[model samples]
Target: MRNATIKDVAKHSGVSLKTVSRVINREPSVRTETRERVERSIAALHYQPDPSARSLRSTHSYAIGLVYDNPNAHYVISMQEGVLAACRERGFGLQIHPCDSSAEGLAEEIIRVSRSARLAGLVLAPPMSEQPALIACLKAADIPLVRILAASEDPADGSTCVYVNDRRAAYAVTEHLIQLGHTRIAFLWGDPHHGSSSERFMGYADALKAYGVPLNRKLVLSGQYSFDDGFRRARKLLAVKEAPTAIFGSNDEIAAGVLAAARSTGLDVPWDLSIAGFEDNPFSKQAWPALTTARQSTSEIGQHAALRLMDLLRQNRDGHTDSSVANESFVPELVVRGSTAPPRSASPRAEAPAGDTDSID
Candidate 1:
């Protein structure tokens, strides 16, 4: 037998199709007796609404797409969890898609997906979040888009955003090390193409200047955001005539690499050398001495970004195109752990020390 239709249910219940719809949607205006009668008929007939037809009629979908090209597994996992939570709470669904960050057809692929899939909006992850063409393409498609951890240069088109002040967070971490008496600190940089790379490096430099330490060109090592990258860079930095007293990795993965490098080279953490990192990833705790890093609210930021994108979609559907809701950022919190401390000795000529004894005054 064919599926029962709303018309059949209404006819069987001796009510109008509109009444059945009201009952199906649980509209408060329907009387209890009428609602009960409609529900009973609906159950008897096994009537169901076509979601696709409804979506087409309404011209709105409760589904959003998440796009990213980042390789950080921790960040990817946390972001999905956060977005999933919001979707559950709001009665929505998510579709995850990975983009090509440097491919020639990147913009075309994003634009085609946005239009073809009929997505309500998109949540962009870095370094795609910082791509100008991709952003423009999404905007041209007239879909709401939220960029996570995007730089200030991207235009704010009233789309929702969740970001961290990477520069400020980096500065704070470096300052923490500086106050602990680590004058010669080394920086393991993120991908130079990424927006966070520069922001974080600037923060490190800013802290060195504030503490009246000379900016040492030899101490700054540029590396990608990965364990292997950090490992190789750390080895190079440590090979110099006089190595740094501390090393700051762009993220926890890099920090883990640095920690590994330190161990293999016989440099004890926060004893012979200090280390710190950004983005308090799970790897931070697994290291020999837990890493002291900046805590960026990855999950919470993802949740907020999803909610904001939903709001933007609602507004756009209502014929309002206010572009003021775009452009947002989050300030990361500092989590001091066992990985960082004052230099082995405050005096440059003194022998290596032990543990994180000197607090940041």
Candidate 2:
């Protein structure tokens, strides 16, 4: 049988085509009894509306665009699933487009896609969301955009964002290590260009200060958001004369690198050194000893971001609810595992860098 149309539903329900349109679009003002009758006819006939025609008539396409660039497969997958769930609930469609802003011609690629596609709104996940030029191009296109995992510096009032308090979470994670009596904790920072990198560093510094641990610039290292990047940074930290008893990575990938470096150096995890990672990725478990980490709710963050974007699309304005944005800044749950313990009294047996082992007193 041919696909059911609006005309067929109207005839079967004994309602006008306009009334059928109202029922399908879920527009208010239709009588409850009539609406139910039209809905029943639609169900029976299996009527499907053409999104293109609907857009032409109402000038509103029930579609959102998702733009993201990140190497972590787990983070990308969770974000997609969460956004798709929200889209299904709101009777909307999603158009996924990927571009690496770090690559040449990235801005042009994004502009081409956005201008050609019919999008009511867009959602972005970093490192694409953190790209200043990409954000500018989207704004120039005059589309509403929501940024996920964005930094506080990325113009909050201009573009909507769903973010965590990175500073607070980092501080909490650091304090946990300090409380375990690990005075010499090495720090591995993520890509400095992204907003999360600096915020997390501040949190780490605040925690150390609060606990009266002497700040050591030598212990802090910066790296990109890849496992390889983590590996290099961890090596540098391990090579220090008096290596830290604990290492805090910017994210799980980096922390895993620390684990590998420690293993190669013949250090027993927790007994000789403690380790903590961010984002709580699955690889944390596969390490020699399970990793201690902060659990960032990837799926929930995606869902919340999409829901807020839908609200903006409907209202045609940034949401007036401060509580909505405030509520979105989630605190990651700290999961302590086998990777951490009180520091050993005797120094590590590994081949540590030669130095005086200067005390900070």
Candidate 3:
């Protein structure tokens, strides 16, 4: 038996070949009634469009690019899965590119890759997404882009973006610690280059202020977003004369490090010490005592970004001036786990007495 062709589907749907082509390619111009008719006819005949042949006839590329520079392997993988899901549904290909945001000629490098691949659009992750100069360069090159950013409000930079309200989520996490009777909570900050670290810090500070808890500058330490950085900072915080009973890692990796630090120092978790983290990554669950953290859906965010980029690409291709992409934002919700509890004492106490109670003052 022979396979049904586009002409056959067009005839069955009572539409022209052009209309069938538009419906098959998912162009937004097709009328709702016509699109349904084409879809039904295609389904009835089990007709499938040849992606390779369509690409050969079209000027626009069928491949989209996902560009990121992040340290977390788990996060990157999750994001990839989301983007891949969207691309697969639309019969599009995905190209994953990891690069250093600070490297010289970064814009040129991106442009070169896009030109070489004839990319349809691009999805950018933090640090890279937040860079104004890089975004300007892309815009000048007429590249359609969607950014995943961490900020309290939209930048309104004339680009499509998916904002993650890290500040709100961080505030909630800090409030939870305070409610658990932890007055002396320490904060382990992530990389400064990423805007999320700053936003999370703002949330933590705001929460402390709202609760009338004094912000102890000594308790805040800056570091990279990695398990090793978290581990090292946790050790230092634990060794302080008046150790904090509870510690908040910028993300789950750091929180897991705090757990390790507590165990190494012979301190009982949530008894002698308590720890919390942000971003409900695998580390939060796999730890001996699961981490209390915020659930940021990285996959969902990635999927949103990719879908928005595709919309922008379609609009650009159709040469319709009206913007089809809407700005989207996500706020991670708090997930209470076993890793956090009320502090053992209301007053600062020493895990190992250094005989310096004065440091608490």
Candidate 4:
């Protein structure tokens, strides 16, 4: 069946198109009775306003843009959902723009796109958010922007942005392993260009330093955020003379890869070795012996960023400035699951017991 449109509501309510538009925008010109009538007709017809049509009729566009360069599909999807929810709630349109942050004239390209689309503002995801040049360009063009950043603490520099405390979460994960009596812990790096990787590394390092465990350069490895990289790194780590009792992957994808590698080699997880991950993505829970990891709600973070962007747009339009809506921060929750425990060395038993030995195939 065809969906009800704004015109349908106007016709059903015996009101002019202008009146309906006023009611929809919540303008005060319409009488209370007329507004109630229009609203009732809207409910009866289930009318949904078209953002594009509304934008065409107004001087200011009601559209918002989401710009990101993330490789993780799940992360991108969650962020998109959050932004879309805020847009729907605020009666704004959303434009999702996936562009290469490293491309030449990247800032110019985004500014052009935002202007041509008549977007009220933009929500930027890292490494786009981390790029100062892009931010400078957007500000020079008088475009409003909200950023999502990864940091150990709130990096509130007078801009509206969402901060994810990857460093603190990583500290919690490392602390969990340390408390379980694992000294030889391995750290896998995600893409260094992304701020979260470095933040997580710092947290892990901080935890190790605080617990009197000497940082082992040999156990720390650098690689991109991927299951394949995790597999290769895990193989190398297992081959070493003194292997780490626990491995911390920067994200869940990498942790799942390590699990695949361990299973393929018939090693018992959490007995032969313990594994932990960040983000707590689905693969973490779905993996046999669910991965112990940290939880960060990507959806909530994205939604919060988009909502703040909309608020900024309102502030700019109304000529009233409020400093209260500044940088908001979130720390990921640490989750303990079946994939981690005290290493066999910590136990009195000389032999390690069997764990999830099922092959990845």
- In candidate 4, which residue pairs get closer than 3 Å at backbone N, Cα or C atoms, i.e. clash? none
TM-score-sorted candidate list, best first: 3, 4, 1, 2
Per-residue CA lDDT of model 1 for 1-361, tens digit only, reads 9998878989999999879766654445789999899888977887766545445756577678898888898899999998877766554668888877998988778777877777778888888877777788767867678888644234444445776678778878887888788888999899987888888888788777666677888888887999999999999988888898899999999999999999989987888889999988888877879999999878988988887776676567556756445556787888999998777557432222343222221
Off by over 4 Å in 4: 1-45, 321-324, 347-361
What is the lDDT of every predicted structure here?
0.79, 0.77, 0.88, 0.87
Give the lDDT of residue 310 in candidate 3. 82
Residue 119 of model 4, lDDT score: 92
Find the number of clashing residue pairs for candidate 1.
3
Can you write out model 3's per-residue Cα lDDT over 222-257, one digit (the tens) per residue?
999989899999999999899998999999998998
Clashes per candidate, residues 3 or more apart or on different chains? 3, 0, 0, 0
TM-score per prediction, in order, is 0.80, 0.79, 0.89, 0.86
lDDT of 1 at 195: 86
The order by descending lDDT is 3, 4, 1, 2
lDDT string, candidate 4, 45-163, tens digits: 87777788778877878899999998889899999999998887667899999999889999889999999999988999999998787888898998889999997666667667899
Best by TM-score: 3
What is the lDDT for 165 in model 2? 69
